[model samples]
Target: MPENLTAEQWRSFVASRRTTRDFLPTPVPQELIDQLLTDAMTAPSWSNTRPYLVAVASGQARDRISTELLNRWDSAAKALAGGLWGKIKIFITRYGLPQSDYKVNRKYPAELKPRSARVGAELYGLLGIARDDHEARRAQWGRNYEFFGAPVSLFIFTHRGLGEYSVSDAGLMMQNLMLSAHAHGLGTCAQGATALWAKPIRDEFNIPKDYNLLCGIALGYPSDDKVNTFKADRLPIEKIKLLPKNA
Candidate 1:
């Protein structure tokens, strides 16, 4: 006989989870969303203050927000794509060739420094998005605005002047929500992309100006037919470790 399926089985099960962008626009029950929020609040926080807060939107509000985001993205992308051959190279390379009135880099915790593309690649593979599909990939990125078609959207944030520990706490809580969503048969995308929309979103959602927009996560039952399915690999433990000097 055989023992129960071991590490491989568990890995395969979790690995099947992926970031789904091709949403069916079906309505998710309010109770289910409620449960997710409940689980999200359980996330660890510094001094147990749980400074983070969430805003959920559905129906017309969701649609309007996505529309505005797409319009802004199109205008910004076109501007970046415009210019003479010489100028275009500047956009392609390093420098001051293509500048935009709207281009923005979302704030990140420099102290909590992390490499985004590495994690993004894992999700891209699971989403079945090709490495070279810049346009397709970017369009997929825009899905964050639509809550990835899940019919509900979540906004996450914290006070602007939080200390380092608080930001870390928020990140931990976010991770808890994402993992809980996964364990509950929901697909989620940890959306740093939406950081660029912070100002617009803060105004749109009526959040106090001093709260820092941390990130967003789009959650829903994944579409079986869509290309997205499976999880990306995490960095090996060895890669993340440094030998202790005392040892």
Candidate 2:
């Protein structure tokens, strides 16, 4: 904390950190990235057990993962377009079907669906993508595999020994990483899409069997693209806060 920094300034800094979808190809220095991870280590873990591992990809390695991921994304998109038969073919072939350690594409709960839908709608609207523009939508979605042009990709994994607690601890660590990146004038987008195909990651990293992929983050300098400016609406405290039993 800076001696001159106020509480309001800190709040504003946090609020300003948005999920950057478009990033410049400029590579982040390895030293700076190491420092950011050091900052992330400050996050408290469950019982001081930081049961998380991160696999970093940059340069040629990043490109290799992106290539494989893009192929899977395209295959999955084709299967999706083919309807029931498409789904069946992919399932039988196991080509486009998610080989993820965790199910990344499960149906959202009824209560949470609207919130998810709202954010999607808002982002597409900002991008001038029409609701009926399936082709455009698929193209936009495919960008996730490309890491939105980021120069670095971080595959986050959690230890299965602690189960959900490990996942929660990883989430906290990721938040710290994102905040640290923002403070250092970098940008990041945490993408569940990256976890849709674990084979690509597994092929690239010597991850232990006890660790499972949770998600990935695209990291680099944010481009001045319009997508970087999109800000989803947040629920107020009243909406999220719990009421007393009597009240």
Which candidate number maximizes TM-score? 2
Mind giving the per-residue lDDT tens digits that candidate 2 earns over 1-247? 7889999999999999999999999989999999989999999999999999999999989999999999988889999999999999889888877888888889999999999999999999999999999999999999999999999999999999999999999999999999999999999999999999888988989999999999999999999999988999989899788999999
- The Cα error of candidate 1 at residue 87, in Å, is 9.6
lDDT of 1 by residue, 162-217 (tens): 65665687778776676667777777776665655654565568776556776667
Indicate the residue-level lDDT of 159 in model 1: 67
Worst 10 contiguous positions by lDDT, candidate 1: 94-103
Alpha-carbon TM-score of each model against the true structure = 0.73, 0.97
Kindly report which residue stretches of model 2 are placed more than 4 angstroms away from their true locations once superposed: none
State residue 82's C-alpha deviation in candidate 2, in Å.
Answer: 1.8
Q: lDDT of candidate 1 vs native?
A: 0.66
